[model samples]
Target: MQNRLITCTLLLAALGGLSACNKNKGGKSDVTGWNYNDGKKSSGFYVAKPKDIKTGPGLVFVQGGTFTMGATQEDVMGDWNNVPRRVTINSFFIDKTEVANVHYREYLYWLENVFQDPQYEAVVKGAKPDTLVWRSELSYNEPLVEYYFRHPSYNYYPVVGVTWKQAYDFCIWRTDRVNEKELIDKGYQNQNVLKQELNGGGQDNFNTKSYLMGEYQGVPGKPKKNPLKDAQGRPRNTVKFEDGILLPDYRLPTEAEWEYAALGLINENPSPRRSEKQRGEELISNRQMYSWKNDGYDNLRATRKGNWQGAFLANFKRGNGDYMGTPGGLNDRSAYPADVNSFFPNGFGLYNMSGNVNEWVADVYRPTTNQDEDDLSPYRGNEFKTVDVSGGEGNLRDSLGRIKYVNENDSSLRNRFNYQRSYAVNFLDGDSLSSSSYGYGITTLISDKSRVIKGGSWNDMPYWLSPGTRRFLQEDQSSSTVGFRCAMTHYGAPEGAGSKHKTGNFFPTRRQKR
Candidate 1:
């Protein structure tokens, strides 16, 4: 009995010594030297808190849903390109107004300041809109050609004569600027550092990917109190995308997303609950011919209350030789393209969705895209690429401070599901057996470079006002009647992360069945 008692005492003393050792090792009681609890190691990997994503500048949230993405009116041109079909579009955010001359001028100013060298100077010059687009042989439009982009009066007007490529570049530039500003505002980087870097130029500019990859170093500013800590209790300052602080890339909206946003059919199709006793059926009551609520094309005036009751709801040409009607009691109030905010906004709070200037979309034009593309978030022209990591260490930046990418190689991208391709811009357009089966340039005007343009312009008649009516233009060409808006993908729930849909249980305890 004494021997057994001594054994128990020795065992308890050994346990106490072990507990003391654990306490000495930074107060962690992990026996295996692994900070673990409940069969999971705490490796200091931070799961970021759910962040409420604020809307970006000039953007509005567009609630998305299933819609008939095609001709709401008769196919007047009989092209049959936009065949009626049901497709689902995910919720996204889009610019509230078309990019204006003021915005484009800001971009040009940045380009001129940073890229003053000959090579970049030439790039900046190439991005300039073809001002001669305004010149007409029949009419004296030289003054407009000279003053449209420069005049302060037209600063708020939608920017025109910009090619699709130029517009895309603008989106890229805007994304960087907006993200840089966000970092500055969040106290992650100093504002003075940005100014200094801008003045220095040449690979010193604040590129988002470059900064994230530790390529471009900005002067560290006052950082917010860290919510996470290292094993040694040191505060960590890295920002991850999961935190929702960084936004998705801004790009041209897909053709379907653009049309769905323009239609704003959510107004017609309300939520399921209409009243206490009556539930609204999942149905679209009215088929709209234009972006506005009205069915007729003749009535351009607003029927809603306020001083704007009789005001024009959109900007478009009424008839031949009638751009904005007579000066006295003018119909639409402008001779040429009006300010981006000129007309009343659609149900989604987006301006000039139907008229102002025809906007470029991201889709490569195809007559049968409606039939061939996936019904959910339908789009074309996807070219998969990856960051070039061949230089031993990855995340290398170019001379311009932008991260470089290369076409994803087939070997690295191949999978068991059979998606083997270096690129997918024109995937399945042709087979190895035949060349004439899917001829793009040989038989039809359509090519891989042909992008879709939507909406009508100030010079267009009422027939072009339908949101479903689409036209194609070469990606490299500019036009006096073309402008663009930007769209960003929404990350979380379809309705949104903050949505208050039904949760918990669908039935009461008494109603529950075995």
Candidate 2:
């Protein structure tokens, strides 16, 4: 009886140690040998063990890997752009479909309602898509110009006539809204915010940056129990970066990331296996000419075994003067731009990758991008900026209830040499041309304002359907065939926080010593 009691006491002590290990996950600081992350006022660094990254609404994961980027077919246009090169892209999140008419309308509605004061009319106007883009001298596209964006029938169609700048602004707006909702859900923010505050001529609204910096104190007394507490149990107003609550900002995808995602080559690898014995060779079985996984079939993305078998795969012009097809048996069915989610998705469950509309990417146009870009997560367009503090204004925001920024030049930036050198590395050539208004039809049609656009449109031939095909347009210019989607960076693990057998190299977890 005495021996059993002693063993039981020892076991209880061991369990107690294990519980303490979990409670003090940061362990002790090696230098001072003091407990870290303890809920104390002095000598404590708080660290929250947050859950794994959550996939944001309307986004799909694109696992990264090495792939050949650039023209896979004959360069009949002879632009000499998109030269073949091997590059690796880091994992990221992108919209499952193009930004639809309804989504953009929601953005516009908020802008119009919030910025209603006449002084801010231009702000609302600038965000509007140029509905006039559908008009042409040769063709009578007047009806489309009047109805495409506003009409209820076309709500799900991909939004066209939006400039890259407008799309970028939309992304910023989306990030704030998403983060704001997250805080509200976590009881850090008040739910019943006032209407006047949202549209106040002088009052700023709840933005992610301003909230983090303690500028916007949201509506209080909404939730019964608030979780934001300090050491003494007083309510804390602001959330910190280390909280792991707010998600990364939404932005445009880099050229490499876009191309690699469009390819969706993960389908080439073997399916999930239980053990090493069941696992097949790790290899891509075939190369893809279009976004879909083709197996020597002309109709790559069509339904093969159903009533819709051999149906046209993507929405593109069949030939000159061939938009849809002969009356009854229509080819691809889409005359102009179809609904954003009309077609079949690729291996990544991304819809309309090669058709319906060309999507904007975050890269300055360069014919030799494949040659100039870095092998790892390559991109060209970069304007390194810091929160504008030049006038000692102290983290002030512009009229849009957002943070202002200035270029990280020698004077504005803390690290002068770093900014200029990094600019030289990626942003020099583009900035030089941009500073001079692109010389406007002077030396060349291409300019710094020109940005890379990918995928084919409703009016494009099959040549443009290939994922490797590339094109460019001015950043401020809107087009009837050009639309865009948003992307977000994957912060922690590239393969994501998956099980040992899932994301990365499979390894058995070592058992704890008995």
Candidate 3:
């Protein structure tokens, strides 16, 4: 009409100068997935996108050193109550085993098929686990109290009497069934919630960032005939520690990170000339109250298949009419099943640490807890589901009568250390040996019946299997000789390998003298 309106007003003024240079290059392209950049930043770096690390939760680590934790001068039972001391531990991760009984009967069969709905069935029958108090008269444990926790061949042993708050509520139902199988492998659950609930339980929703952004959905939460594709198609989960993905919180090892990881002495490795002498042992040093040195297996040294028969690494009941082998040879399946990898793992791989059962440690019994504990990683105790009314979230108690402490930095306390009052204390620093006492501060007139307990049971006696023998009960006790194992801390390590001090060596070599 006027040359077609001047070529439609010059194509509407070149589409209004391409929409004002995309509104000065930032108003974001009118929506459809918008973009004037900041899609969580892709170039100046901020691309963490996270969540892909998923697997099945594996990690085991442990490391750290500076031993002499409690009694390893061979402990002839002067019952000095785990004296020795020294201390230092850090680096963490655990759970190589020891939470068995068919993985807590799949958390009591998913809390009895999702609390059979009777109004959340008393929190699923109070998440069961009093397996009829592992029954016994003098013996004849009634076929392990009627088929060892519903037999599956005792599904890899270890799960005895429970309690340490039922293995911390089975590590919170194994971190909510591994983040609900990473939210139904990313489709945000539509099925496969452990094979369609296997009878009950299902509606958990699940959507972990649309499977960390790939957009998962092989039918899981449904949708994606082609919705951007990728959708968590690969990573099944469990390699753990490529440097992320751990959040589940089972916690509980702090009696000096369980006697500095039951003194495994950070499992060696050196050789690379940091003053390389090779044999005199310096790089990773010694320590070792029981994680390995009585040898038998886990090879910290003895290369080319040479050492390790020194045996007696753990599984007590020996030397006084002995139990596991001699006395009519092979009694009660060699005295209530040993070999859950027999023994020797410490320097962080973990394993029995000293003997077997006898664990529970979150510390609370304050026998003046080594002057005032906490060089770092130190611990006292608390249980009532580990308190945490929020305020700082980490939580610690004390002040009902007072004793708390805290130093090394004091960001309002998560851990600095100090604890020791479950009866039996001379300690102003005195015990462990006697140097005219100087424990510096010491306090604990008795706080509700002490607590701490560490590696060494299976009917104990190898000098209480030394991992710094200090014992206690009442916190709603439970024992088959006590059992517990779970820890986790190492979250990245950069600030000078997360607080330095790796070199080792200690135990009976001499120190407790004061």
Q: Residue 314 deviation, candidate 3, in Å?
A: 20
The predicted structure with the larger TM-score, 1 or 2, is 2
Estimate, for each residue in 1-514, the C-alpha lDDT of model 3 and write its tens digit.
Answer: 2233244335422431333334434444444434432424321111111122222365466645455666656656564555665656755666664566677777777767644556666655655656666677676677777776677776766766666666666665665567556444544455555554445543332222222222223234553431221223322332111113334345666777776666655445433222213332445455455566433343322333444433444676765656565554432234664545555455556677676677787776655567656565666543211222233312222211111232222233345255333222333334454454433226433444346777767777666666777777655557666766666555333111211221242134555655
Each prediction's total of clashing residue pairs, residues at least 3 apart in sequence or on different chains, is 0, 0, 23
Candidate 1, residue 135: Cα displacement in angstroms equals: 1.5
Selected candidate, larger lDDT, 1 vs 3: 1
Q: In candidate 1, which residue ranges exceed 4 Å CA deviation?
A: 1-42, 270-281, 295-299, 303-311, 416-418, 430-442, 499-514
Q: lDDT by residue for model 2 over 1-514, one digit each (tens)?
A: 2233244335432331232333444566455656545546335444444334578889998877789898888899998888889888878999999999999998887778777888888998899999999989999999999999999999999999999999999999899878878877876666655354456433366777666655556674434554445665455556665556787789999888898999888777756345444654467667788888764233543656777777877899988999998999898888999998887788898988988999999888877667766799988877765566544443467777776766556554555654443243235344553332345498777776788899999989988988899999999998999999999987544555433223445467898899
The C-alpha lDDT values of all candidates are 0.76, 0.76, 0.51
Worst 10 residues of 1 by lDDT: 497-506
Q: Distance (Å) between predicted and true CA of 140, model 2?
A: 1.8
Candidate 3 residue spans exceeding 4 A from truth: 1-46, 49-66, 77-89, 93-103, 107-140, 147-158, 161-176, 181-192, 195-258, 261-356, 359-454, 469-484, 493-514
Ranking by TM-score: 2, 1, 3
TM-score of each: 0.85, 0.86, 0.30
Q: What is the lDDT of candidate 3?
A: 0.51
